[model samples]
Target: MKFLGSLYRFSSSWVGTICIVLFIILFVAQAFVIPSGSMRVTLLEGDFLFVKKFSYGIPTPHIPFIEVPVAPDSDGDGHLFQGKRPQRGDIVVFRYPKDEKIHYVKRNFAVGGDEVIFDLDNFYLRPNEGDEFIEQNYDKSDIVILNGQKYVKEPYKFKGINYNPHFRNAMRASMLGNLERKSLAMRPIMVAESEKVYEYGSVKFNAFYIKVPQDEFFMIGDNRNNSGDSRYWGTVPYRLIVGKPWFTYFSIDPDKKIRWERIGRFIDTLQSDESLIYEQK
Candidate 1:
């Protein structure tokens, strides 16, 4: 009884309070702010939210501000305890593969062994389970056939995924340039056995294809046209996955008005409530 009393006193002290806060920040939930329009309507710039760190497992806790990993990734997989992987259409927050210090949020487009086609700034997915699987799961109207294989076209449209058509020509040029630079796995090819035509001072191809490697995931932002994602840099390994957005604590637009309606709303609720989704003007 005496020992319990002493422990309770210590916990109520300032130093102990600080420790408790750090523990929560490291393993429970950490605060993050959306710094860019990469996620657009789903997550806007200046929105502050908490990230559920335990959602995908406890990644090695990093010191908060400086963003230094507190413990070495001894097993080199980046997790202290392994957990479930992110599924298709899930919005995920992860460390940028090239730079661990940077955090990026994007939707999981496809998973391991899945084939993806990028044509004219749109995405088509052929799941790893193959043709019959696509036919069984997706609506017939949404499926497109290329080279006798079925691909789901713009599968996440209901999730508010969109790209700017005005940027199509520029995006195509960028895609071809990235392919040539070999930064990502996108390779130009004529699907459905069509002939290649020349345009933009290079071979005009039907589409770019990439097969997601086992245990890796392809990520693309909801704001498709503007996001720098796996399409440009390649798939993300499970190790870099950080967590899921929990809830918006505060939001402010560029005009500096407090967005009272957004605060206290859970991420899941915001995603499913279509009326609340921002419509592009």
Candidate 2:
């Protein structure tokens, strides 16, 4: 009888140890399935990506259930593990500014102290003390010049049955033939002057100039028209950043047709080092 009791205790202890280890791993490094198309081409709606926790740094530990009491008037922000700093063009997963519980993924377009401007539908970045803006190409359609100046606009056509041509094209190639002819329309224009203005698609409004705070980042999705990013919410604090995606582990269509080609593919940061020369005033 004693031997059986000892065996039970040993089994219980082993199970507890295994469970603790699993929890740590899941908290630090794990995979997540994307449910929204905000990231689109870079991260598909149904793609599964692996995130390494230590990629950035050790994360601050949060009390499991109770809040720990610290010194009065103490800045007790709970980040424990220190990690590497995030750079421009990195795909980062972070907590939504509005709701800390909700997580979002976007490419880091500009870091703090970087003057980012979107004119003529082109994104330009100029670091502090930098002479000129570094122009990078996001999409061919993102470039739209109005009266010799740049602006951002959303262009859409009713070429597909679902009202979204790009999405339909991704689903079925044969559906291209079934597309009915329709008029193409351009959304409102948004220009960057003293402040940032959003005048296109679902999110349209004039927003004030945002100075990215220290250790903060500006994130945007490649799918500009569909994504709600820094232009909508705000800057993402460095401490809230989760991790950078390394590779795609799985991609499945609703039809159960797996995109074998996309699997194991690395996420590419859409950026270029080439110099852009434009006639200046």
| Clash number for each model | 0, 10
Spell out the clash pairs found in candidate 2: 56-83, 56-84, 57-83, 58-81, 60-79, 60-80, 119-150, 120-150, 120-151, 121-151
**Pairs clashing within candidate 1:** none
Backbone-clash count (model 1) = 0
Question: Which is the leading candidate under lDDT?
Answer: 1
Could you tell me the C-alpha RMSD of candidate 1 in Å? 2.1
- Number of the top candidate by TM-score? 1
lDDT of 2 by residue, 142-252 (tens): 544433444323322111101134443432222111122211111123443435554433545332234466778888775544556775566887777767776778888
All models: lDDT?
A: 0.84, 0.54
| Model 1 per-residue lDDT tens digits across residues 1-281 | 99999888888999989988999999999999999877877777888999999998898999987989898899988889989988988888899988889988889999999999887656899999988998898889999887788899887755567786655577677777776777756777778644544354466668878899988899988877777888888899999999999999999988999888889889877777786578754
Tell me the TM-score of each prediction against the true structure.
0.92, 0.59
